[model samples]
Target: MRKWTGGMLILALATVLFLSYNFIGKEPHKQTAYDFFHPSNTSLAMGSSSHAKSQQRIREKPHLIDVQGLDDLYLSLNMSEEESRSLLVWAQMRPLLSRSDALPDTVEGIKEAATAWKELLSVVSDTRNISDDDPGWKDCPHTVTSFNGNLSSNGNILHIPCGLIEDSSITVIGIPDAKQGSFQIQLQSSQVLGEAIPNVILNYAVHLPGDNVTDEPAVIQNTWSNDLGWGKEEICPDHRSNHSIKVDGFVKCNALVIRSSTEVNVNVSHPVNHQSTNNISVGSGHMSVNFPFVEGNAFTATLWAGVEGFHMTVNGRHETSFAYREKFEPWMVNDVKLEGGLQLMSALAKGLPYSGYLTSVLDIEHLKAPPVLKKRILMFIGVFSTGNNFERRMALRRSWMQYDAVRSGNVAVRFFIGLHKNLQVNLELWKEAQAFGDIQLMPFVDYYSLLSLKTISICIMGTKILSAKYVMKTDDDAFVRIDVIISNLKGMVPDGLLYGLISFESSPQRENDNKWYISSEEWAHDSYPPWAHGPGYIISRDIAKFIVQGHQQRDLQFFKLEDVAVGIWVEQFKKQGRKVQYISDEKFYNAGCETNYTLAHYQNPRMVLCLWETLQKEHEPNCCE
Candidate 1:
């Protein structure tokens, strides 16, 4: 075995040198019309006749086949020259290559497999002609440290150029209108160039107790996105905390009360009896408390960015704290908007980030030539992104992609982006692709339904192009710990490995009203196979190769959910008498950031940079503060 391995190693070295001179040294291989094979439909309901015709049509164009490359591939797989030659001969005679472990029995099957592989190999790079030139990038630094302004009818707006950082505070002095019943203070995201409206990071609303004697003042805080409206509200004097009171006779409810120089508390009282005996003290001592806001009464409120969330202090007393929500980071809050029935006296912001340098310590010199593809990569990361997510991509480049493993070429990262319908977006995307050599542009237009194609493309790149040992699929919004993931993979089986935050018992979303609705026609199964969350997951090379081969041969069933499709393929591979190891780790946070996470998902651009900064400063796997 040692002699055979030694001979194969030598043969592999020789083949690499030849291929390096011919292929690697030359310009990147431009994709051709036949390079990409778009599936007709995502479902496998099509007849065998059409499938066979499609296979035959694809096999007719076998000019891209590199028979010598097959020999090299087999040699690299630790096969001796004689064994490699035998396999090649058998592959040509095989009837068809249907599965990963199934070897061709006849010469025809071998030829079909080789043809499919060669076609897969033909997809080297994006076909669109784009230059590799640096597009000029300029820094937009925020020099304004403070802003003080009086309220207008529009409710004074104070713009935060570089957004807030830790300990950043905004103070407002306003009086609730006597005639109005409610007022709102909002921390909002800056409107993007093409976006119709900005996102509301935090909406703090106060409903006043007006002429209605039965009504009591209430405070509610929540987040809102332009895509998906308002999130769950976390109100002051939390209803969940009012478990002490029963609603049978004298119903007792809690209300948040703040004093100018005393501790804040939730005062519980029985409204029907107006009894002081029912009053429950939440602060230091049992004392009468009052609401901070009063009709036509002036008040001072300060909102400070904290490590966990945003903390609000009314009249020098802590009132409420809203824990940051997923996709809503403090740094994304670029504008303080006061609306509703408030007469703002003045507003002031302090300790906000003044420059990008304070937030992201991105080395521009290193970006000129990012460490990528110098040698065989341990893992290939394909981040799914849209054409307009330039900021997200840039954040990734500046953050986790700067890790030693990635910079040293142990891990290669690429953004798998699809074209946009808008010409201007496509133009900007082209420029970005040209500037950054890490983008893998797909041929099809970007659509939520077509995401499966990008996953297949990642497999192709990982197996046929980079020949990585493991292939990981994640989103551009996620932060991946490359060294930690590599360390984890080291202790696990190297083949048929599907590692991530796996979901074992999940059913398809049959509801048509949902975004992830899976119709019975698209998927016949009642329960989906165990699969990792879509945000991040890893699979070994054998499984990736199988997926690529299955895709090329048109044997793999396409699913709209890319991660589930991978699960289906992995399950099939396991059925082929291969030992499949499913490693489920909770550290792979699919929903939001957490301490010591393997991969934190649903992060915005600001959070990505923050995560990186925290990791660097602390030298530990800590989420963004």
Candidate 2:
């Protein structure tokens, strides 16, 4: 001991501390449900607060014990695992499960939590039968009641999920005290027959006086989803026109319409009944198609009852504008019917199962976007993706994306994906968003031709929502050398400018049948002004704000060719005598890796991994350090 060296002194101290923790941490073991899932390490009693029967209750409801970080603290003095798990599920179920006031520590409460999770999970795949035991199920005012002998052989009321009926039935959802001009119905569907995509209708009606089987004007019908858009790729069977879409709807004055308003051209906009023939629904028909029901996807359809008529959003993007055809008081309208042979996975009012207490497919809030942006985010590399591009997004996540600069919050890198009509992809996207918390799901339909709108949407989100000062919009297939980008951005004067390998005098594609094709009708201008290629580009916060704020509903004349559209915005700004600087940096190459580069694009997953290796080798010191 007197002759102890540095290593010897460290060993002596380690022995003392280890013994102290072992002996001082002495506590009798108690029953803990948390330890049953993940055994605690602090050496507590095996029987402290832990009961075998209480643990069994928690095992029945596995979803409740998933509360993260519950293992960090010991069971606070006699807090039983059954009570803790019960409380966690109780709090979550207030909004998620039944609205019933479930009391804790009682066996009934535990059963409620178990039943809620079991029912929620069971109906996700097939919403066929809901429990009749919950008294609240059959009593809600907004509950759907079957009428007109739709399924009278089974029961006057349709099964909670309305069964797998081949024909659309006359079912009424009762809304109580519904005297508000604003009402919302959250719709989710897991299975939609391919044959029913064109004729699904949701007509809103109010409970008026005198309805013993024949008083007209008794129902104020706010028709939603009449003559909406559908993909032409399935009908046409051509890859080039694979991007082709069609809008089939019926509108007299305020008939429902869903069409792209930004992409200028009949082939692009496809609007039927609105002012811009290019931007709204058109055609005379009886049946109104509401939601695009893909076979396996679970999508959120939000329809709001407004004074004018109704406003709807498929995910979050503005879907379509419908004016009111019926003159009844808007606030009094409550009941919404599933007409036009519509199939549904779920229909919930105020998030409660509305179809006579049918099971919810899944909590709609599970897909809600996470809070990603922090106050001091210096820059963002926004990767534009679609619902289907899972591989490319994952490659970026593993390679250069896992950097200290990104993890430390100096550079916030995220992928922005648009919703696809394919329900399977949307469901996966929702789960991915939950896992990474780096994904922003825009509720716009992901058409390959609408890439420019996607770019504009991300730009708007970056500048306005995320408060990112500098943003680099790239594809899922692209990779940015984060260290170098952070270095370059640190020295630049950041505003009113776009940076990339700029192209000047690039002529617009006039071909009629190509992805990049532009018709003279869509754009009268001969040659496009110098614009950055779409693979990658950079912009300051001001430039991002300028493009988004100025371009609204075809305001900047958004052509589907996103890069060209951006160039158009830059040219317009220059004409207005505003500073529109184009920083032409060759280092921002469009393909593969280089010895010294700011960014690279169109690289596959394997190449990205190798490029990240090379990027690390090319020594660049941290500029901030």
Candidate 3:
């Protein structure tokens, strides 16, 4: 009996030991805020042993001190310890990892940074294996063409469901408010969220005579975009010029206004020439007919999209025709806004093309399959994007990604996006990621303040994964001509090339209200290092590797401005006795589109499609028509 009891005890002990080793003694499954959005195919689960080894290696280093400022930075970001450490391990300081004072000096801090670095690498490394298969196509439903409405008051807005096209015409019947000095009719594109102002495709203003008796009425026409601000004004009937208005192929005033009769006692002071007096029509002959637009005038104006530009006919007479600017294409105008002194009675738009008619030629749905990275790439373009910018991403895919370089896998492009605050958006983004296979999901909440992390992510992708000869960082709203850029890069030296619209002397914005604001606490310098504009910039593979390795070794510096941060890194690389060629070319347009631009920034989705179409048809660099 004693032997049997002992045997039972040993069996129970052995069973308990096996259970403990299998479950209890092992690590718990880690949960992240983004786990629900992350697909199982990707590496959401962490590898503890790898992180442990990394932490051990970091802890072995001496002369490490605790960085309290970095702790505060992590707090300010409102990220968990793991995320904060991951960011620090990715890039030190707020933006770069170059500040020795900001480096983790203590064993605990070092381990945190190192562990975070390993986790980030593990998550983003999966981007290389993303499926490149094309998602099957789906047909789009029909869309509206014409819009009509009345502008009842100042600042009244009307929607054009389908933007304008050739032969599209808009007619407005309104009376100018006499008390107001000026009124404006504007054609506006769809407003984007982050843009400070909506793009104005056309700005038509009519200024009435001032209080001064010598003042004359004026008419002006122009175009405006958020990036370019405003184009040259096409003013009519200059007060200094002949009363007969002439603006070569643009403006001609043939308006007739009945002059107001004011009785003036002649007193017979001088004998007025009978012939001259007869020259004046039936009454007091001061005809206010030179300017087409006037105060208190009930006028019917029709504006139509024509071959060259937009033509305006006021009261059945052609008043003006404004030449088309580079990027303000007729189809880009999505809505009309009426402002100022006009009381609009009715508005009507006709002959507008159906929504898909203009863009159907793109055949975005039936686009070619996404290119697989089979060989070494000449360039890897990492676009910084947000989770909800679905249209923008699709536009890029349909437009520039169709280039031969990208189609042949000589160039690779991927969007780096972080998790969205909204779960629905995250789900959609995940679906998009699965469908496109061109997006790399960063494991963090997306914010403008965290954009520097995206820059680091780009370098990580370009060097650690795709192994491209050059890495270029650009925005989703930009249009990049891959072939042109590649041709530009051909003659250049391969190593340490930093190419873009370079800014040689730019001061750091100190005011808190500025968009690119940097507090003295963040950067104690007066001017930023020579850096390329953020809209588009390129660096050689070696520089990209230095950025990646610098973060891994805890030596790179951090700056809030990504472009300026890159400049800081390149400066550090130069300090290491390496040569860096800073190629500042104007062809990389930092603002809106220009003639023969290599890359144009702030282009809307429609404009992107238009640019691509123009490039293909013309076989040259041309702005969107």
lDDT of each: 0.64, 0.45, 0.63
Candidate 3: C-alpha RMSD to true structure equals 21.4
Span of ten consecutive residues with least summed lDDT in model 2: 230-239
Provide the TM-score for each candidate, comma-separated. 0.50, 0.43, 0.47
Q: Please, what are the lDDT tens digits per residue for candidate 3 over residues 239-259? A: 333444232244433334323
Instruction: Give one digit per residue, the lDDT tens place, for model 1 in 1-625.
Output: 9999999999999999899766544442433222332232223223353543233122223222333223422323443443232122122212122222221121222332244333322321333322223233223233333333344445567776546655679888888874554677888875644566677888887766455533445677777776666676655554445444322221122344522222334332212211111112222323224777778788999988764578777888777777665457665667788766777777788775432331244555575325554557789898998655667788898888988888888888888875443333444554455455677655444545657767877887787767798999999879998889999988998998999999999999997534467887666669988999999999999999888776566555567778888888887777666789999999999878888898998787789999889888898877765
List residue ranges in candidate 3 displaced over 4 A. 1-373
Candidate 1 weakest ten by summed lDDT? 270-279
- The reply for model 1, stretches above 4 Å from the true place, is 1-150, 159-173, 186-204, 211-214, 220-292, 295-336, 345-363, 367-376, 383-405, 415-465, 474-494, 501-528, 533-536, 545-569, 572-579, 584-625
TM-score of 2: 0.43
RMSD of each: 19.6, 26.1, 21.4
The list of candidate 2 runs beyond 4 A from truth reads 1-376, 552-555, 617-625
